[model samples]
Target chain A: MNRFGFFILFIIIIFSSKKLYSKNIKVCSTCEFKSLEMAIESSCNYDSIIVEKGIYKEFNIIISKPLTIFGKGTPTIDGNYRGEIFEITSENVTIEGFNIINVGESFKNDNAAIRIKNSKNVTIKNNFFENIFFGIYLEKSSFCKIYNNSVTGKATEELYSGNGIHLWHCKNILIENNIIKNVRDGIYLEFSNQCNVINNISQNNLRYGLHFMFSNDDTYRKNNFQNNGSGVAVMFSRNIEMLDNVFQENWGSASYGLLIKEINDSKITNNVFLKNTLGVNMEGSNRISFKGNDFIKNGWAIRVRGASYSNSIVKNNFINNTFDISYNGNINKNLLHKNYWSKYNGYDINKDGIGDLPHRPVSLFSYVVNKSPGAILLIRSLFALILDFSERAYPIFTPTYLIDNEPSINKSE
Target chain B: MIKILSYCFYDITRGYWISIYLSFYLFLGFGLLFLNNDISSAIITLMNIVIYLVPFISLIFGLTYYYSSREFTELLLVQPLKRKTIVLGQFLGVSICLSLSLVFGLSIPFFLVGAYNIENIFDLFVLIVLGCFLTFIFTSISYIISIMNDNKIRGLGYSILIWLFLSVIYDGFLMSFLIYFEQYPLEKISLAFVLLNPIDLARTLMILNLDISALLGYTGALYKIYFGTFNGIIVSSIILFIWLLAPVILMLRIFKKKDF
Candidate 1:
């Protein structure tokens, strides 16, 4: 017998021994193992428990073993206003196809429908969570997958509401295809690193749809955030890639489509911000690149407050925003390059789709309103128009260096 | 009064001036709509032009029409009509023709472009209605200026100055005042100043219907309190109506006691 032939037979024998050792356990009211807790306790490692179709009124179903729990007909686990339904502490546990409800309301401890603590390689998929304090709480966990779940919380007050999916000090989590509403924040990450959040719908949340604080290297793409208090807030974060998200209709004095505060080394590309009070309220954010985004019909698109430095705003379409680029001070440290402004009426005589003259985005009326907010009442007045025209002909009050160098004459890219 | 109003209406409509004015607005409306390619944005451009052009054209046309028809006005004054009837009837005749021409002209493009299905129809309605108010307000103001001054050049110059002040100079003064006294809480005071000018009031009314109202409320809670309610709209429109009435009543009184 050659060495390669023996190696293949040895691999087949090891796989056949694992299949021969692991067994399936049945869980139902009429079955031998009536309760899920008893079934989980009696099952051995690497065993699969198939739960039948019945209402199991249980709470604190702790999983400290490596077992895969699947529901045959999606059985209901009614917590009945009790504490945490599934507390996963061990690694390599999978929980799928169950309806969890009525997690006890504890504002201090945050009772979640499914709470995974200090566990790795946990997979939770295709679950329905209703009337819970927190939907999925991932703490100090790594390589966790939360997929295809729906979380609806009956939260009204900001203080009483918990987030739909809260991650604290976690790493390398994937949260995709989740629908969350009526929570404080749809998805919140605090100190969590390298998480990928994609294809989520978070709308009508009481606070921000997705909030990241001190979470680095997070990529969120193709998420729809609408009608929340604000769409997304990334504060004190770095190396974040936000791509192809749609933020719309978050309208208030304090609300913005995306609030980037104290963030650095991030890329925001190809997102559409529509009808927000202020789209991209940027403050103290440095070296961030904003490219190929659309700002449509917002009150203020990219209002740069103090200390936002070296940010290159390139190739974005600014269509019908009341003020395209509102800067508080006169020091222009950012680059405005090759953007399309609908208000740019400069001649494109060179016929390269770029205007012949540079376009000055901020008007004197916007500056006056910034100086004295009462002057906003004079918007669109003929006197304001005259002031803008004269300031254009004779530079004053507006930043002279803030010009779109290659302003597109038409709406292209 | 009705007979004199009808006679003046037929007399104005018989001239090519009314057709030319109507066609100018039609061409402007269609051009703006074509240029913007979006009905909502087209309404914004039309608002800017209407606020400036409606008053300027009304002031110029009102003064010129009044000056050119002085002999006809004297001929009607010697008839059995009361002075109140002659004055208000001729004023109503000019106001109605201008208002109808503006409203009808701007609306044709909207209907043709199917803007009536979108939500911008209400904004269009406000724009044209404010343009009408501007026509009435400025025509009455021009009548006051024409009646006060016997010299044609002085009246013409005075009308231009008033338009300049109301449309341009008044906002400049208000801006400088706000910037100068920016320390004080001037939301209410500045709102009161906006109410004083009919042109600014008309502009404010149009702005309230657009998304820019959210920006107006972004200053402070005081701006939101003042400019965020239906009562704010009602109050502004009432102030605009008062601007129309006050000058009109004064013009009637001055023309009644004039030595002509």
Candidate 2:
């Protein structure tokens, strides 16, 4: 009986000590731990630090402990335009409700507002970042969540600007409910996999709003990308699912709502591309399914440039675009079916809601415009009309097999 | 001039061909609107019809009217009326009647569909203005041809030739030149070419209003830089007005010098 009581007492002591070790440390001007660096230095593992509302002029803050840092009233961490504000290298760290600003600009170093390197299960939430070189950058991190952060920067040129939420060699990241603007690229992923980027607004960036390079098996949904220079670019990626994104007002000489290059096995559905120079400028993309997308009031809905094959564009509404589809090559390899083209003039004699005649989405004039852009000046001219009419009648010049066999007789609701 | 214009207007409006022309456009306008169920697409289809068919119908009808009214013109020549007054009266009458028919025929369907409230009013206005310009320009050209050639067949043939040249062959030559000289900077040359053809000018004006000049690609960018501005619209409208006045004045000069 005495030995059993002693064992129970020892277990109770271990539990109490564990609870005592994980205590809250207050960091304020009047507190014992006046500075965050001092508090972090004295705190144990799994401790919570409550930082009060004040300006902390600190840079190169490296957090190596698995702790929780909570800002009570949005304490500002001013990096003084010197270097990175936060560098987290520990797993299961939570940094919440802080205002991080003024990350240093460097040509060689990618100084970020919050840099996570070789960390796992980190949560960075409710942070406001301004004047950042790179915002919330992750390097070799996995199973991270970046939630409800606002990152704004003054990015005038691409050479000096960095991305807002950049992920490099990361996996299983959930980046959601963030607003990013005026950076080089809003959310950039390079060599990352299995990232879920959802419900984010990215606009007014110096470069693309969302850029994917060598990233695969990623899904981004319900994102709004607007007025960014050159818009979104997905390059050298595979198995990307982009759904219900609004790509709007991205207008320029060579701009596109989505510039897809060398991508494969992607599904782009239910997206609205409005008022852009080009809705989708695809090159060398294959086996992609584009369905239920609305291309409205764009200059060119789709400009297929280089050897795209086996892509199916189905059930899309192409409305009021200047050119619905412009193809560069003569080889017809893509499948276009059941799309409602505003320019279609075929009839439905049996009233089955499908046109009796096939709709040719690619006009001969579009082929000419691709060959010689100067011929665009003669658009809507009688010669262009005659050329298009004769090509329709004779099935020459335009690719004969590039036709929509099942064009929707009525516009899809 | 007003009395002569009113009399000519009454005679033309009562003619079966004018009624047929009005009904044709009316049917086309309503048919396209009902079929497309969208104002923008209907406008696009109607624009093609207006650019191609409007000038064709105007030339043939103007030429035939000029030849058929030769007796009336001779009877008026015996009166104290000035040749300028009589010719100008007839030209104004035919152009106005045709323009009225086009406007009424195209607008009724838009009204029935409530497109005036839904669409850009300026685009519809520009379409009507372009249609009127084409009518005035083509009718004046036909009148000049009729006055120059007393033989009806030759006059009709010349009218058809002018129409075909302006509407089709001119664009073909311009396209070929652009293609052959693709390496050269053809922005200015193409702009000049578009201005020289009244049909192309009307089409360009409509395209500018449609805001799809961006589809024109590089040349479109050049056009947008020049014609996408307020000053561009003013300048283009002035040029179109000049195109209207030049043909009428040339026809008047030839009519005054003609040995009828």
Query: B1-260 in candidate 1: lDDT tens per residue?
Result: 89878887898889999999999989988888777766777788888989999999999888988898898889988888789988899899998999989988999877886745546888988898889999999999989998888799999999999999988999889989999999998877887887788888778778777766667765545645665577876777678778889989999999999888
Assess candidate 2 and give its lDDT. 0.90
Model 2, range B187-242, lDDT digits (tens) per residue? 98899888888898988888766745556655677787788788887988899999
Per-candidate chain B TM: 0.95, 0.97
Give the Cα error of residue B103 in candidate 2, in Å.
5.4
Docking class of 1: medium
Give Cα distance to truth, residue A313, candidate 1, Å: 3.0
**TM-scores for every predicted model:** 0.91, 0.81
Identify the CAPRI category of the predicted complex in candidate 2. Answer: acceptable
Tens digits of per-residue lDDT for model 2, A93-133: 99999999999998788899999999999999999999999
